[model samples]
Target chain A: MITKNRKITFILSLISAIIGIMFAIQLKSNMNPVPNESRSIAELRSSLQKELEKHKGLLADISKYNLLFYQYESSLNEGDSVSVMKEELARAKRMAGMVGLEGEGTVVRIQDAVIPEPPPLSDLEEHSYIPNAVIDEDLRWLSNILFANGAKAISINGHRIIATTAIRNVGEDIQIDTKTIRPPYEIKALGDPDVLISGLKLEGAEENLKLAGKQLIIEKHDKLLIPAYTDARVIRFMKPVKTKGES
Target chain B: MANRKFYLYLTLVTISTGFLIAASIESTKARNTERQNEKQFQQETQLNERILAEKKENHQLEVQLLELQRKVSQVEEALAQRQSEAAEILSELEAARMMAGVVPVSGPGVIVTMQDSEQAAASADVTKYIVHEQDVRLMVNELRAAGAEAISINGQRLVSNSEIRCVGPTIIVNGVKSAAPFVITAIGDPATMVGGLHLPGGVMNMLQDYVKIDIQEKEHVEIPAYVGDGKMDSSAS
Candidate 1:
């Protein structure tokens, strides 16, 4: 026969097991709500639009400056000169080799920059951003020289560098799915040859390029004419930061 | 003694069964409560997840909207830029046209001849130093600046609405084919316009800057009437 005390212990144990199971079920049900990740994405988009509008206005102003310059130039009679003078256009349109005499200006070449392997601590959590600080400094250095030398505009491949445009750090070996460009970058600049060349040399860009495993070449000739892009982009939208965990 | 033991055993058996039943009842209630609570919690969690997903989707749409807004804004900017530039050029042309006193004969304006340098064409890779689009834009800009009342290429008219574009080495004037010694004509003060283009650092300078480029500015230059339909279609937006 079972003892009274033993029987009571068995009953208590069975009840305890059932209660434990119920507690477990409650815990599982609690895990349903995760809202922060998705909401953050929406918030980001609203902010970026406001930023783009501001920059767009600035670009419009710069274009106005160019238009005013254009209008003022057409009124000159034969043999008249404008504020900006061209040494070559003064004569018949010059062809290659005709203007091939060695000029004293800088030479610009464009190429690709290789991406280094990421560090061990790059657990994908710290947010690996493009090296904006370093890239901006290099670009700023280039800009200072071009500005000092009176460059009206500069083109990389066919892309024009306008007054309001910026040289952004796209990524290492991936700019809009194209290979990342770095050294020996080919840049076509419009301005006074004497002024532009001297300006590039002023900021010690040559030495800086050497240190950074890159190069800068600026070629100045009356024959250096680049076509204007028919479809120039006025602005691009900024992306919002990704939400954590839920994404 | 046997009877007493049997009675004791029966009482014990009854108490144990009653306790077991009570425990079973409590367990059943607790399990039902737990399951209901779990279902409620799951529904709440699912709702939360849905809300989060919706929020994320909304955010993505917003970003796309922002991008579209940026693109449209840029288009508007380009349109304004072209208009102002064209206007300025038109005003200059009008003034030059008044000074030159040329009448509308239902024909294009004075034609200025642009050609590859007669001497430079013999060189290797002649195109390397050919006239560039910018050069044309500069010259055209100067023409407008100089008051070109009406302008055209070959036979196309230069209205407040017209385009002068270059394709590779060839020039595109109002969808018409043209090449070196691009025949650009302007109506207005023919003499004044020619003089204005010849101005140092004007269209002449821009053209000269190109490879093997030559520009001929003339007055009273009779430009042919547009033969081909100058169908002007522009997507300003």
Candidate 2:
């Protein structure tokens, strides 16, 4: 009888221990569940959607180019290739920023902030003052913001921004395409004025400029003219990549 | 009496064990139903596979489009050879397209690769060490100042209106989002571009502390054409 009792006790203890371990595991897993996989799955779904849209766009581009090629071939057959070529050249020139363009857009003016008069000599030590000045980086950031907001064409002062245009500081002066520009810098961009204005505001352009001791003044214009890139562009390094059939 | 007590203890322990098992089963079932099940895992895998397939197809279509564009160019060249007037116009158009970044270009230039500093992942102040949109813009400006004729970042060709800006942690170039490391290829004098980047207080010097940058001069660098919308509808000249 004693031996039987001992066997039962041992079996019960083992069963109880297993239950305790299982209960601990269940409690632990419930408390600290695995990282949410659903969130990542949602991300994957959105990315997939973006890729599908891009695929559609690429398909559209291919069709458009195919149509253009067909037109060229037809023009060749009709002996009207010159006119068609001229039209194509004109379009290329316009897209190359080789000609002036005018359209409805927005005008942004950046000016140096006016400093108030100093209170007194004794109060100067406690007052930390930042100078009000417009820098090259400010213009670069503003132009980038404008372009991202769908600005088709942009010009600062009178210098038109092109593919190779560089805005940088040459010593103390801000140069746009090798021309020194001064404040208050007047920036004209051709696009939807409301959208451009909202872009600037959304980027907190005013607040940023204010922190730098400059003022941002934006105006919507019904007609804004952006000049052509005047700097002489010499292409020396780049050559067109030859196609497989071309010699 | 002892036997009776033993039976009572055994009954209590068995009941508790049964209760623990039931609770565990209940929690496990709840979790499985709440978060992820086998079906959800399978669905996620399927979605991932679809995305990968779509990306592959898009790449193939882009190549096909490039070929078609080249055919057009070949035809134009053949026509230009037949007529002198057309020849002049064709040459001008070629130059304009090159300047507008509408045509693929190949030449000797420098490629600059930039990435977030490795220490940034461990550092508390991560923003200072990571690459930003301003850093990229500054790099491009420097390259252009050094006379980079053609430039592209991660295959996105730079055009007159190309915008490089930061949206969250990714950099958007020509309306497409990409993350570091950004590889900027410039077709120009490699030595001059390298010098420009290394100038004291230049973009490289300023950003060197925050990011990892490597500049390589290569004899051949091929830049693709701008695939974005080339038409300027707002510009009515």
CA RMSD of all predictions: 24.4, 4.7
Question: Cα miss at B193, model 2 (Å)?
Answer: 0.4
* lDDT over C-alpha atoms for residue B88 of model 2: 89
Question: What are the per-residue Cα lDDT tens digits for candidate 1 across A1-247?
Answer: 4587566656655555555555444544454342333334333443344334323432443343244344334536322222212221211011110111221233466333344665567654575534232353354346435544544345555454322222433444312112244543456655567777776676576666655545455566765554332322211111111222111
Model 2 TM-score (2 dp): 0.85
Taking all chains together, each candidate's TM-score versus the true structure is 0.26, 0.85
List model 2 lDDT by residue over B49-127, tens digit each: 9999999998888788788878888888898888888888888888888988777899999999988999898999999
List runs of model 2 lying over 4 Å from the truth. A1-19, A22-42, A76-79, A114-126, A244-247, B1-31, B34-50, B230-237
**Top candidate by TM-score:** 2
* Real A-B contacts recovered, model 1: 0.00
- Sorted into a CAPRI-style docking class, model 2 comes out as acceptable
Error of 2 at A156 (Å): 0.7
